[model samples]
Target: MKTTFISTQAVSSATRLSIMKMQAELAKNSKELGSGRWADVGLELGNKTGRTVSLRQDFARLDSIKDTNGLVMSRLDGSQAALEGMLKMAQDFSASLIGVRTGDTGADVIQDDAKNNLQALIASLNTSIDGEYLFAGIDTDVRPVTDYYATPVVPGTGPKAAVDDAFLTAFGMAQNDPAVINITPAAMDAFLNGAFAAMFDPAAWTDPTTGWSSASDQNVRSRISTSELVDTSANANEAAFRKIAMAYTMVTEFASSNLSEGAYQTVIDKAAEIVGEAISSTTVVMARLGTAQERVKNANDRMDVQMKILNTHINDLELVDPYEAQTRVTALETQLDMAYALTARAQQLSLLNYL
Candidate 1:
């Protein structure tokens, strides 16, 4: 080939162009090494980094929901435990009446025994968790058991009456605001003189201290519940309580504390059945609670799965791939070194040097 010596200016220009191209390539490779992506994202999540961050945020939110579900389930489980204990107590009471007789128990003794159980039932109704009463109707702040006495009344409170002739009302019987007082239904009845009605009477409640007197204390909700607890003439827990109470009463009446085998058997059988009812009630509650627990667990499991998937997606979008990144880094380092050397050489270039 003919001698083709380029002018110094031309060589310098060519070197400058080459250096610029090399720098652009080096930047491209270095980016890939640092970010693990082949290219930059425009506006959309066209790149993995943006997508990964979104996935990570979603994962964290789902985990929080799962934790809340678990807490509710735990509270349900604790309530189940309390119910189980109540069942055992019911069973023991009935079992004592197998072959017992009324005469064997004292007249007053039967009433007293039932009263004690009623009190215990009241106690159970007052059960709470995390400071909230379980059976306080809509008012969870108050205890369920207020008293064993009578209904409360504001003085001179009359029956609800119509205000006009069109309304066919004579007078309005309105209770005072905050009318609810903590007195037993038995006692409240005496205050209101409402004790004569047999519905409010627990035949087994006859103690002079616990009698139908004005001294009773009870919550409004608890008072209302007393009617349900008392055995009605239609269907009564009275016989059940009465039978057991009588058995104990007889022990006092008779010199013998040992009940006859026949009597004991009868009492035991009744007691057993009552216990079964109590157990069934408790079991149903527990089963419902368990269902809630299951839901919580399922939520947690779902959250866990979701979080993992989100994490993986997030990783795909944001994580640097070590293998690709390292390769790019190596190439970039070489280009950077070459660029520095070329720049230095170009600066030193001269006509004499070429000669």
Candidate 2:
């Protein structure tokens, strides 16, 4: 025991190592207190690392779904507004046609109104959001309708073109020809209920390249939730839109007081029937859209609740107790201050101090 003595260098090295260790711990405690999160999450939750990681991933997924749902809600809202506008316009046009008095002047004015409404209806059908056409089905990049006024309505392609072709093919006369007055009710009815009607048929709609089946009505769909998918878009080729197109095509292109009473009455009667059918079809579409919107909203609400719970779980896994961390930080600071004072004092002392 008398022969054993620790060297000065050894004492200094031991003191420096201890001070460095305390400083490292103090820095960690300070970080935990300042950031409100654990400084060493893996060390704190060693066995629960897998569970915490999974929870954080789930929380991230929920956030992404919420952002996507917001966009979907906006699109659905816009579609509802456009559909309602088209419905109101259809209803008004139908009402106007019921008691219309046909004179040269009145007929011309009616034609002008019909043309305007047809263009309006087309504009509504081509509604888009963020450069995505809402009525273009899976083909969102392509516009659903060509501009009625700008482009020539190609035969066998578009609504107006088909109507124009049908008028010529059925009566063997151009639209608004005086000879149309000689056409019988049976003939007019056959044409209206046959090929002219077929032109608007959803069953006949097809694209050569995409081959989007008309049987599905060409509505674009989106997966709104993990398990539920919804048709986010409306089909412009639906019965309601077609009926409005047909009526508008007739009044705008075929209205005439020069025709006999029978031919003029035929236009009025056919249009009224189609318009009535349109109102019914529109009501059904509205109901369907309303149901879809409700589904989207409900999913959003559920996800919101899930996100809050997930965030709490994630915090429990990664966050520090502020009071506990603050207490540790204070204690570490006091220890570090003492260690520095001792180290400084130790460095100033030497073996030849008491000569």
Candidate 3:
């Protein structure tokens, strides 16, 4: 019989190596038990790890879109509220014009109300959230409308100065000139339809030297979902906004009380027509925004369902059974304790102890 001699040092080294391996497994199982997830997702899932990776990416994308849709909805709600307010102002101004069609309401009262409404309209267009103007279209950093009543810091660079220049260019005189009484309905209508209308054009209104609005013609667009992109902002350069400005300017700047009866009637008639168009256009814009809001909401609903399905799939691939993990952890701990006790006993086994 051949006897195999193994040194005590070799026996102790082998026991220690086995104990270290069991300790490592114990640590891994302990973590899995606590977290209820696989300790090594890539190791456990192997080639199918790519599927979880793709699903997780899709889940993250849907979460990002859902977050962005919240902001888009906020902007749309703000825009709708502002447009509704503008529509109300147009309705009230139109009613005021009708009240004065019989020449019963004082011109001064109408002029005062028009000036206030114009200022309010500009303020509304310049509405902002976190320093971003809602009606600035894609030019969110810029204010959409300039204050028409603001005194020009420069000689000919203010919104009021631009109006004055247009008025002078059209009529050969200032707005307050006493000779305005001699202005005929034909000449006033021509001026209103021509030079005055041109002032609110997107190109002219964005002119650096003399402009009423700095808003972009292109509105802000947002992706509400993986497939849906929608416009999320309004622009001050919309014809509805321009017409409201024109109607308000006609009453405020035309020296309404000084005009001949026929010319005053023409101004009122033109303002009434413009106000009606503004109201109709605003209603259309509101309806479009409402539609966008509904689409965004639906997109979120669909994304939520997709995310839930994705999470379930991911959990199946990446999560561990906590009860099984805990049982393995308990077994490994018992093995480690026994292995440590044996390793210690093996180290203690020396011939000198028997001596």
TM-score against truth, every candidate: 0.43, 0.85, 0.89
The order by descending TM-score is 3, 2, 1
RMSD of 2: 3.5
Best candidate (score: TM-score): 3
Worst 10 residues of 2 by lDDT: 207-216
Pick by lDDT: which candidate is best? Answer: 3
| Cα RMSD for candidates in order | 15.1, 3.5, 2.6
lDDT of 3 at 270: 88
Structure candidate 2, residue pairs in collision: none
lDDT of 1 by residue, 48-107 (tens): 555656666777767666564554554455555555555565555544333233344532
Q: Which candidate model has the greater TM-score, 1 or 3?
A: 3
Candidate 2, after superposition: displacement of residue 140 in Å?
1.8
lDDT (CA) per prediction = 0.44, 0.76, 0.87
Question: Residue-wise lDDT of candidate 2 within 1-355, one digit each (tens)?
Answer: 3776677677788888988888899889889889998888889999998888899888888788778878888888888898899889888888878767455566667777789998898888888899977766677777776555554434345545556677788888977677877877677778777877675566544443222222235676667666788877677767777778778876777677666666666777788788788888988888888888899889888888988998898888899889998889888788888878887888888878967
Task: Write down the worst ten-residue block by lDDT for model 1.
Answer: 158-167
